[model samples]
Target: MILKRFFQRSQSPARSCYEAIVAAARHPRLYADWGVPDTLDGRFDMITLHTYLVLERLKGEEPEFRQAVVDEFFRDMDRSLREMGVGDLSVGKKVRKMAESFYGRIAAYDAALAAPGDGLAAALARNVFPDEEGGPDIAGVRRLAEFVLTQRARLAAQPVRAIAGGDVRFEEPGP
Candidate 1:
């Protein structure tokens, strides 16, 4: 009871937003037949993409809340690593690497979104299909990029209270 109260009291407003992002990213349709590899890196990339969207949505809000969400994200990453049997020391290093990778992704994705033409697809192909044998699936990259743009617009339209309360929802990879 004491522990529950302690945790409940400390919960961030962005907790639900994070949970919503993870839930959508983990949707089986993203992997089962969508061409996303069912491997660890694939999963990480998807999660990072979704999380980055949420962070971008938070950009116009209080800086502290955005930082809180980011901090909470790393905490969740640390917990996930431990749950997956990573040793404590290695977990820190791995999470550090993940953070660096995510920041890089953020820059690439932001640039792609800002640039003209098929830059978003190109960025997705490079990041999400980095290990594909013949090369990235152009169709799949295009579809994923479409979804990102759609979802970003939807996220931006959501009331801040709804997002903060974790009631966010996303359309699938199509209209």
Candidate 2:
């Protein structure tokens, strides 16, 4: 079993892409300079956003590959919940809810991206900073929106072959 796990870990491009997504999401500037709350939900939102960007870029790729990447995401989420000491009985339910949240974010973000003006920023503010009183920090959310737009274009310009080979690259988020 250990050897099998090792082999899969070493061979999976999906794994590499998932890792890249997590690394990008964990960039400290996102939480510190960009005003994303340094909390579990905030982190999840960031990861979801990055995942959407990659998936969007992968739209015309093999269906199996896309599904594999998504499977990797859910597996990681399951592991995260387990590590957080969530009871086994509750983990599935929580993951289901998370999946719902992810899909919802994807839909919102996708539509907002095509919307005119501050639509994307508004969506990010609503989803990423949901806990903020009155409203999420508009300026911070706008900054994040700009980052997302830039990354989306960058991802689009990247060769699909490289991304399919798990060579995804994301620019550092900065102030």
Candidate 3:
């Protein structure tokens, strides 16, 4: 239900892009941590507007806006990454990796939806559009979000241990 709620709040074109960026940043396994900026005003506003345009096109309402929004989104992402002190090489690599992974997942989900089944395929399909019949399934999305969040939480809660050779050394627990 939490994922459903999160997505519900995220479905607003005005907010979904920001939420997506936040979600990506929060992913525990991410390789970099640029830390939060002092303010999210301009960047957030740009992302929201760009995302809204993308959503409008996806919904077949304003198809012409997609390319412009996409261009603006990349420009904003690059600027934000630089402002956060992410090195040029690192930013480019990370962004490309993220984009590839994101697009791959989306494509896979779309393919799954085109198939005829009601199991994992159905679940994957649901992720692409979590609000329509045979489309997005809130319950499924919630399950996935919870699973990812739990993994992230576990990673965060883990104590840092030193590994030497083949062995790990951990600090003693407090009495």
Model 2 agreement with the true structure over 1-175: per-residue lDDT tens digits: 7788767735588889889999999999999998899999999999999999999888878677778888999999999999999999999999999999999999998899777888898889889999998888888998999999999999999998888888899999866
- lDDT of candidate 3? 0.40
Which candidate comes out best when scored by TM-score? 2
Least well predicted 10-residue stretch by lDDT in candidate 2: 2-11
43-135: candidate 3 lDDT, tens digit per residue:
342233224323322444334334433544566567778998999889988668645644555454444435655433344333333344554
lDDT of each: 0.82, 0.91, 0.40
Give the per-residue Cα lDDT of candidate 3 at 1.
72
Candidate 2: where are CA atoms >4 Å away?
1-9
Clash-forming residue pairs, model 1: none
**CA deviation > 4 Å runs, candidate 3:** 1-63, 118-175
TM-score order of candidates, top first: 2, 1, 3
Error of 1 at 63 (Å): 1.8
The pairs that clash in candidate 3 are 129-136, 130-136
Which pairs clash in model 2? none
lDDT of prediction 1 = 0.82
Model 3 alpha-carbon miss at residue 40, Å: 15
Which regions of candidate 1 deviate over 4 angstroms? 1-11
Task: List model 1 lDDT by residue over 145-167, tens digit each.
Answer: 88899999998998877676656
